[model samples]
Structures are given as structure tokens and as C-alpha cells.
Target: MKTTNAYLSKTVNELKPSGIRRFFDLASGMEGVISLGVGEPDFVTPWTVREAAILSLEQGYTSYTANAGLLELRQEIAAYMAREFQVAYQPDSEIIVTVGASQAIDIAFRSILDPGDEVIVVEPCFVSYSPLVSLAGGTPVHVQAETEQEFKISPKKLESAITSKTKAIMICSPNNPTGTMLNKEELQKIAEIAERYDLLVISDEIYAELVYDEVYTSMAAINGMKERTILISGFSKGFAMTGWRLGFVCAPKEITAAMLKVHQYGIMCAPIMAQYAGLEAMRNGQDEVEEMRKSYRRRRNYMVSSLNELGLSCHSPGGAFYVFPSIQTTGLTSDQFAEQLLMEEKVAVVPGSVFGESGEGYIRCSYATSIEQLQEAIKRIRRFLEKQTS
Candidate 1:
């Protein structure tokens, strides 16, 4: 006589909701709350990109695209990859246009992972990673990239985590929540380990263009990595096109073929208008992209300096728009800090523990909002901290 969701797939039922969204939901009904938890860009999509989608709709170009997406969009993605990241992928056989980079990651795991296979999920990563791997019939092995090492996983730690069940390693450069970018040399070391273990590398490069001080390097660009790497990128973070739901996956031809099967069955194709917008974004959106990057860079500087000034030891992130600042000095756990800050100060931020266990002592504050919102959020947080000390 127990109430139950017995009809639900065990995986779906057992999976907890996104930790990022729990707090976002908590703040949704509150008035005057400055929510700095979401990682979305506050900038509007560039005019040219938005206009292209509008023009396409006006012209009645709303029919479904190829299962892999519009060929022209795919070609542009290939060209952009070659030009920006020095990675070459054949548009025809090696690319699948997806609903978002999130979908791309989902399909990539579905295509290659078998039941009981394992993927080493580098921490502290995006919230969706482990759940996606689970849904795809794979086990997610969490591996911490220590804060002392600037949130980068060392080769020794990575190798130690590998097991006979290990089939792949998933890494995000310019990582979400932390904003730590893995450079070319660091990536080369990971590539060598991947080569040694014969494990595939799923590189999420969605934030590749938002980097501030360091150069972004694609895992596939590393020597001998092109074949073993599945690169996922999209227009969401960098191009400010989140609502458009357009992203692409680049992999070896065999892998792409398998992923296309999953994608075609699950999603069929990305939206036609969104594809047009992405086409325009890659072709002529660099200047606007840079403008947004500069804004984020300026905001990042302010947040890092301000957080440090407030005694929340924060590492300077090389890229991306979020800052993970340690709140350990206050003797409060991350969850307590985020919750109390929200309740008292009406400023909403995500507790870092939601990202992964290694994120226990920190909280992630996104600098993607306006400078004004950020400044106000900081002030509110300052008042909250003073109360804690008092």
C-alpha cells in the first residue's frame, strides 16, 4: 500500500533533480533577490544572429533540416573549428548538429557507452554530466581536480582512477562553476594518458570562446588526440544563444555515425531557424562575441577582487564567467553559506557542493549578470558575511 513511482524507469526515478536548479527554484518566487546562480550570459544574442533567425522565419524557411543539421551550418562549424581551435572535422561524416551541447554530450555517451562501462567525470563539473552518463547506461566515476592544484586534475590522479571498466574520460576546459581552463600543455598530458589507456576523451568546449587571460585549446588539437576525442561545442555560452538550443558534436566518422543514429531517433534535427542563426553567428559574429567576452572579463576581475577582499579566498579563473570562492574561513559549509545568504540578504548563489563533492567548501557566483547586479549582490553578500562574523 506504499505510494510509489513504480512505473518510472529506475534510472529516471532514482536520479536526483539538478542541484543547480534547486536553489534557482528557491529564489524564483522571492522578490528583490539578485540571483547569481545561473551561468547564462546576460547579453542579448548579437543583433545579426537574431536577425538571421528572424529573416529565416519571415522567409518561411521553417522546414526540418537534415538529421545532422543544415549542411551549410555544419560546414561553417567545421571552418570555425579549424580557424579558432585548429581542429579539423569533416562536416559530412564527422559532425552531428544537436539541440544543445547538453544533448551532444548525452548522445555521445549513448552512442559509445554500454551497460557497466565507466567514464571518469572530472570534477567539479557541470551538474548534468553524471546523470547523463547514468541514463546512457554507463557508470560515472567522479574524480576531483584539487583546489590546491588550481582545480586541475593531475595525470597521476587520472591514471589511478582508470579501471578495466573505464571506457572514456569526460573533461570540460574552461570548466563550468570553477572557470578553470586546461591549457595546451595540460591537455597534452591528458591526451597522453588517454592514449595509454586507450580511452576516449569527451571534451566539452562550450565555453571555449569566453576565455579571458589564457588561450583555449581543443583536446582534438593535441597530437594523436584527434581520433580519440569527441569534441562538443555550441553557441550557448560564447555566442549567447542559449534559448536557440543549437549545438554541434565533432568526432571520428564511426562515432559520429553512431551518435547520429541516437540523435535522429531522439531529436531528428535542430530547429531550422536556430540553424540559420548559428550559421550567421559563426560567419560574422566575432566582434560581438569579443565584446561580450570583454564584459565578462571585467566582471570577473571585480568579483575575484571583491571576494578576496571579503575573506573568501578565490582563485583567479582563466576563463568562463563563474567564480568558485572558498567560504571555509567563516566556518560555514557551502550549503549553509548559500542558504543563509539567500534567506538573509536575498542574494541567491549556488552552493559549490551541488557541482561535486570536491566543491564542498566553496560557492559559485556567476559574473554573467550586469555589473550593477553583481555590485549589489556583492554588497548584500558583504552584509550577510558581517552578520555571520558578528
Candidate 2:
């Protein structure tokens, strides 16, 4: 009989597993390992959100909701989007609650891409974007954004990457791996490119609530862009509800209909109880979000300053909870720095190279952990650096 590995689909066999998880697994049981890896918020889900879920269970709302999710939850999402970002999406036909922002991205790609269609992906970004596009039978074309550029893709570079095969552009503001956020002016440049090329734009704003220095802008709010943008966000980072697996997509009606077809066949709907929790979050979680954002901002300031003082150059991130610090000064490749740091001082960080080719000389350090943990980790890292130079 053929082996299971042999029987696996070629696409499945070819897909690269997440590099973040590999390091996380390595550091899992090591004593004194202070992980600056993993981008999850360390905070628990707010009591009110959890209480809402418990109440939902008590009310016996365990059944599957409509394939598009509960109408009420969708309405809350619509209202939340309007209030927070000033972007209006029709609850009835333009929104679909998803298992997570991850799934929303998957379905968005499936809805829009055909085999060989090219999706322009900016780096250093979240690890999943390229793989997800590939899984959807689309080719991912990468555009490297350097630290000098604040890691924002330049419009000239973006325009240069376009081709007859290019069908969409995927972006993450308050980007993962690096916490750099694109401003309104930056987004307007990208909007012009998308409009000129008639390309779909998938904007993942999962960390929208975590921005520290400036107001977050929704691509959908850009003139002439809403009709072509598939806006993906969720309760995970903002509401500390990662385990709830609740996210949503706001797109034009036709695109939403296509995404819903894939969602119905695959996920059916987001977990019903999670939907209830998300409803609570959308309606009542802004204070909790702001509190978490403030905590992250303080951590970001400390981490960035500490890294630079230690001879590792790092930029001050305006959003998200990560700082991408250049490790080139240490005369070590990113993987070597991460591996040695973990083995020596037990301070775990993700190598920037894992995010993309452009990330080779840097490392991603997440500030999502508590200030106390972050302080300890910083001390450990400093000790390790001292040993290296000594």
C-alpha cells in the first residue's frame, strides 16, 4: 500500500509549515524560557465577553447559525465598523462572520483567485499570507519593504510589481512580525495603485485597536476603494478573544456572496457561542481594548529603547505589539541569533528571516507579554549579549 505521505496532495506536501510555531514548540517546555515570540495578547478575555458566552450557552444557543452567521452579530459588527473606522458595511449582504481572520483571508482568496492568479504580498508580514494565497491556487508575488521605508511598500515598487496576471494586493497595516503601520497618506497611494490596476485589495486589520501613535484608517473608507476592498478583522487581538475564533469580513455584496458559498460548504458558520461573545465585544469592549493598547504601548517603548541601547537597532513601532530589531550589528544571522539566545539565556524570539527573504538581518520581539515578563526577558537578553561580546 502507498504511504500516507505519498498519498498526500502535492499542494499539501509542498506547503511550508509556519516558522513561528516551530520556535514556539522548541521553547515550549524549557525552564526559564522567556518567549518574546508568539503574537497573541497575553490578557484573558474580558469578563463581560466570557459572561456573554456563558449566558449564550445557558440560553441553549448551541445550534449552528446561518452560514453568514447570526444576523444580530453581523449587525453589531456593522455598527462597530461604522463607529470605530467610519466605514459603513451593510449587515445583511456585505458582511460575514468567520472562524477567525485567518479563515476570512482563506475564503477571500478562494473567492477571488483562480489557478495561477498572482497576489502581491508585502513583507515582512505575517507568515500565513503567502501560504494562504498559494493554498487558494494563487501565486504570491512578494514586494520587499525595508526598514528605511518604515517597512511600508512604496507606490513605485507596488506599481512596478503589477502585471497582466496580478489580480489582487494583500496588505496588513499595524503589520505583524513588524509593528509598522501605514498612515492615511501611505494608504491613499496604495489605493491609487489598486484602482489603476483594477485589482482586489485584501486589507487585514486584525490589530486595528492596538495602534499607539495615530488614528487607524480603514482602506474601505478610502474613496473608490470600498467597492474593491475585502476588509478582514476580528475580536482576537482587540478583545483578547483568540480562543473564541470569531472574526469577520466586510466586502461588497458580490464578493461576500462568493466568500459565503465557500464558508457555507467548509466552516458552516463561526461558532455560535463565540458569535455571542463577539456580539458583546463589539457592543461593550472599547474600554478593555484601550487598556490593552496602552499596556502594549508602554511595553513597546521600553523594548525598542532597550534593544537600541544594547547595540541592536530597532525602529519605534506605531502599532501592534512587536518590534523588529536588526541583529546585523551582532555579526550574527537572525536564525543564529535566535537559536543562540534561546539555548544560552532562554530568551526566545522569532527570526525575522522566517517572515520573508527581506527579513534576514532582523528578529521579531513581541511585547504582548506582561511588563514584568518583558523586563525579565530584556535582562536575560542583555546578559546573553554581554557573554557574546566578552
Candidate 3:
């Protein structure tokens, strides 16, 4: 009899599971673990959004929506994009609501990539980008954004990474793990490169609303970029609607049509209840979103200051709820620092190496939890570092 591994697709078997999951699994069921490992928002989905979903169910709207999602929700998404980012997308033909930003990312790759095509992925980025590109039968060429660069890729680095087989570039603003956001000027430089190279862009802006000191710019808003960019964002990060699993993609009609084929056959539509909740969020949840962003900003400030004070040497992140601090001074690798912290201090944080090689000496600590918890976690971390140095 053949083994299960033998029957697995080579690509699937070769794929490594997310390193974040490993730490989460270990921390689960452990007593008194203060976890900063996951990037999820600690805040509950707003009462209004939840109530909207409940109301939708009470009204007996439980059946499958249109494969492209409800017309109402799509229109709201279009309106929200235009209002927030100044990028125009027509409701009727240019949008597809998805299960989550993850699904949107997957379908975008499926829609545009052919086998052996290359996609330039910026790192340290979210873990899924490379694997998703590979699963789509494409090669993921990573362009490292070093810490000295504030973890933002320069246009020259991006241009140098392109080759004849390059088909797309994946960029996440207000980035994950590092919490670095690309400025409008930086995005314009990238836009120029994309146009010159004739490459598509998959811009992941899930954390756009969480920016603190800097304004978030949509790559689609840049000149000539709207036609060449596939914009992916979701309710998860911005609206704290992770469990609802609602997201959307905005692109040119041709690209949207192609992605719709994959989305239709695979997902049919985003959940009907979630779509209604999303519509409600677009309409009435902006204030709540801003409140959450402000809270994250406060926590981000506290965490960055505390981490640096603890001798961790963290850069001030412009957005998102995470602080990436170099642990090199502790004379430990990122994995070692995280593991030791979990073992000795019961504070779980993600090793930056899990994000990319450029993240080797750092660790990502999320400030999405409460201030009290942040204080306790930092105290424990400081104790652990002192012990290490001694």
C-alpha cells in the first residue's frame, strides 16, 4: 500500500506549515501564557456589525448569495474604496466579495499566473504569500526589505528583481510582522516600475485603517496603476471581523471576470450573513473602525517604547498593532529568543525568522491585547532578557 505522503501532491507536500501555528499550538492549553503570537485583533467585532448579521439571519437570508456576492455589498465596497482611498471601482463589474483576504489573495494568483511564471514578493511579509504563489504554479521570488530600510522595499530593489518571466508583484502596506507602511511617494515609484515592466500588482491593504502617524495610500490610486493593480482587502483587520470571513477584491473588469470564474466554482460566494454584516460595516462601522485604530495606535506606542526600554531596540512602526524588535543584543536567534521567552516567562511572541530571512534577529510582538496585558508581557520579557544577559 502506498503511504499518504506518496499520494500527496508534490507541491503540497513540500509546503511548510505556517511557523506561527507551531507556536500557537504549543501555547494552547498551557497555563498562564500571555500570548502576543497571533496577529488577530483582541477587540470583539463591533456590536453593530454583529447585530446586522443576526438581523440578516432573523430575516431568513440564509441562502447562497450571487457568486459575486450581493449587489448591495459590492456597491458598498466600491463606495468605501472610493471614499477612503480615492480609487474608483465600479460596483457592477469590478468587484468580487471573497471569504477572506486569504481567499482573495489565492484567487488573484490563480486568475493571473501560468505555470513557471514569477511573482516578486516583498519580505518580511505575511507568511502565506510565497506558498500561495507556489500553489498557483508560479515561482515566488523574494525581495528582502532589510531593517535599515524600515522594511520598505525601494523601487530600485523591486526593478532589479524583475525578469522576463515576472508577471506580478505582491505588496502589503502597513505590513504584517513589521508594521511598516509604504508612503505614497514610495508607492508612486513602485507604480512607475510596474508600468515600465508591464507587471501586475497585488496590493494587500488589510491593515490600511490601522495606520498611526502616516496616511495610507492605495497603489490603485497612483497614475495608470488602477488598471494594472488587483487590490485585496478585507473586514478582518479593519473591522475586527475575522470570524465572519468576509473580504473583497477590486480590479479591472477583465481581471475581475477571470477571478470570478475561480471564485464562483470554488467558493460560490462569501457567506450571505457575512455579506450583510459587511454591508452594515461599510455603512455604519467607520466610527468604530476609527476607535479601534486609535486604540491600536496607543498600544503600538506603549509597546514600542517598552520594548526599546527593555533593550530590545524596536523601530517605531507607523501602523498595524505589531512591534518588530531586534533580539540580537540578547545573543539569541529569533527562534531561540521566542522559545526561551515562552518557556521561561510564559509570554508567547512570534520569531521574526518565521516571516523571512531578513527577520532573522528579530521577534514580532503584537500589541493588540490590553494595556494591562502589554505591561505584564513587557515586564516578563524584561525579566527574561536580564536573566539571559546574566
Q: Among these predicted structures, which one has the highest lDDT?
A: 1
Candidate 3 residues lying further than 4 Å off, grouped into runs, are none
Off by over 4 Å in 2: none
- The regions of model 1 sitting more than 4 angstroms off are 1-4
Residue range 314-385, candidate 2, lDDT tens digits: 999989889999989789999999999999899999999999998999999999898899989989888988
Task: In model 1, state the lDDT of residue 213.
Answer: 91
TM for candidate 3 is 0.99
**Tens-digit per-residue lDDT, 1-390, candidate 1:** 545786679999999998888889889989999989988999899999999999999999989999999999999999999999998899999998999999999999999999999999999999999999999999999999988988998889999999999999999989998999999999999999999989999999999999999788899999999999999999999999999998999999999999999999999999999999999999999999999999999999999999999988999999989999999899999889888999899999999999999999999999889999999998998998899889
**What would the per-residue lDDT of candidate 3 be over residues 5-64, giving only the tens digit for each residue?**
899999999999999999998899689999998789998999998999999999999999
TM-score, per-candidate, Cα-based:
0.99, 0.99, 0.99
Going through the candidates in the order shown, the clash numbers are 0, 0, 0
Pairs that collide, model 2:
none
TM-score between model 2 and native: 0.99
